[model samples]
Target: MTYCVGMMLDAGLVFMSDTRTNAGLDNISTFKKMTSWETPGERAITLLSSGNLATTQAVVSLLEERPHAHGERDPSILGVPSMFQAARLVADTLREVIAQHDAAGQQADSAFGATLILGGQIKGGPPRLFMIYPEGNFIEASSDTPFFQIGETKYGRPILVRAYDPKMSFEAAIKLLLVSFDSTVKANLSVGAPFDFHFYRKDSLQLDTTGRIDADNPYLQLISQGWGDALKNALESLPDFALE
Candidate 1:
């Protein structure tokens, strides 16, 4: 299991994903769930993936290969003319990989299924974000739904709902995401750091910031401890229920 989120902001886009994958209590591993592509002044694309590791890796590999595969009809994410088209290409690739591995072919519940969050900007269009499913369909982020999450999402969703502000600075957004991720890490062993993240400033057509945050990072430690203390204090300050 994993946790991944992509947020659309007025300032730009922010993405983060956890690295843990496990088959059982004894078989745990860390694999990066974030993949990105950039063409400097032309485009900057990042994908956060969840679900079957093989399927997600295959989808990404195919996307990486297609641009250089001569006579390929489908453009790579890098070659796509717009973010929308790039999303379509990713969705198709995800569906194709799942179909190859599952007899049922493209079923969302198939053992080989994967889900992806695709976000970035192409040269001619405004930045965009999308959530692509295993069935070759997707929906773009909009004013009404300006963020996307895939995999182990329940534990961390509430903070994003209550605190997200589209106009918030990148610093603020990253802090918010850390708190959200900290909550998930506390609740589920499967979703944990070190987390990987990317930031793209709108129209920069290049990735602005990218890094990994290990469990020992001082700032993450601060957010985790501070948020817990704050939550406890808030609960204490609330009016208590009394049985009459």
Candidate 2:
């Protein structure tokens, strides 16, 4: 299991993903769920994946190899003319990997399935975000749906639904995400730190910020502790029902 989020904002895009992969009690491991592609002054793209580890890894490897997989004549993600095309390419590749796995004696409905959140800016287009499903279809994020999450998403979705702001600064966005991730971590054992984050600035055509946050990090500690206190205070502040 995993938890990953990608938010589309006026400032750019914000992404967060947990590193924990829990196969079983003794098989837990940490693996990065975020990947990026960059061509300075041309384009920048980031992908957040969750689900079957083998499927997601294969998708990522194929995308990384796209440049060399085909000679100069092949149009790789870096050469795609628009963000939409880049997402389509990702979806296609993911579908292919799953198909190959199925052909290799795995059942069509095997556990080897994955989902992805793709967001980035192409040179000629504004930043865009998409949630690519295991079936090779995807949906774009819009003002009404400005973010996407995959894998164990329920625990953290309300925070985003209630407080997301299109005009929020990158810093504010990150703070919001931290609180959300913290809430999820408290409720679920399948997700844990060190969390990974990436920020892409609009039209900058470069990644603006990237970092890992662990359980002991001071600011995260603040958010986790402070949010709990705030919630308790809020509940107390509300009027209690009177016995009739």
Candidate-wise lDDT, in order:
0.92, 0.92
lDDT of 1 at 58: 95
For residue 182, what is the lDDT in candidate 1?
92
Write out the backbone clash pairs for model 2: none
Off by over 4 Å in 1: 104-109, 236-244
Give the TM-score (vs. native) of candidate 1: 0.94
Model 1 agreement with the true structure over 181-227: per-residue lDDT tens digits: 99898989888899999999999999889999999999999999899
Clashing pairs in 1: none
- Score candidate 2 by lDDT: 0.92
TM-score of each: 0.94, 0.96
What's the C-alpha lDDT at position 87 in model 2? 94
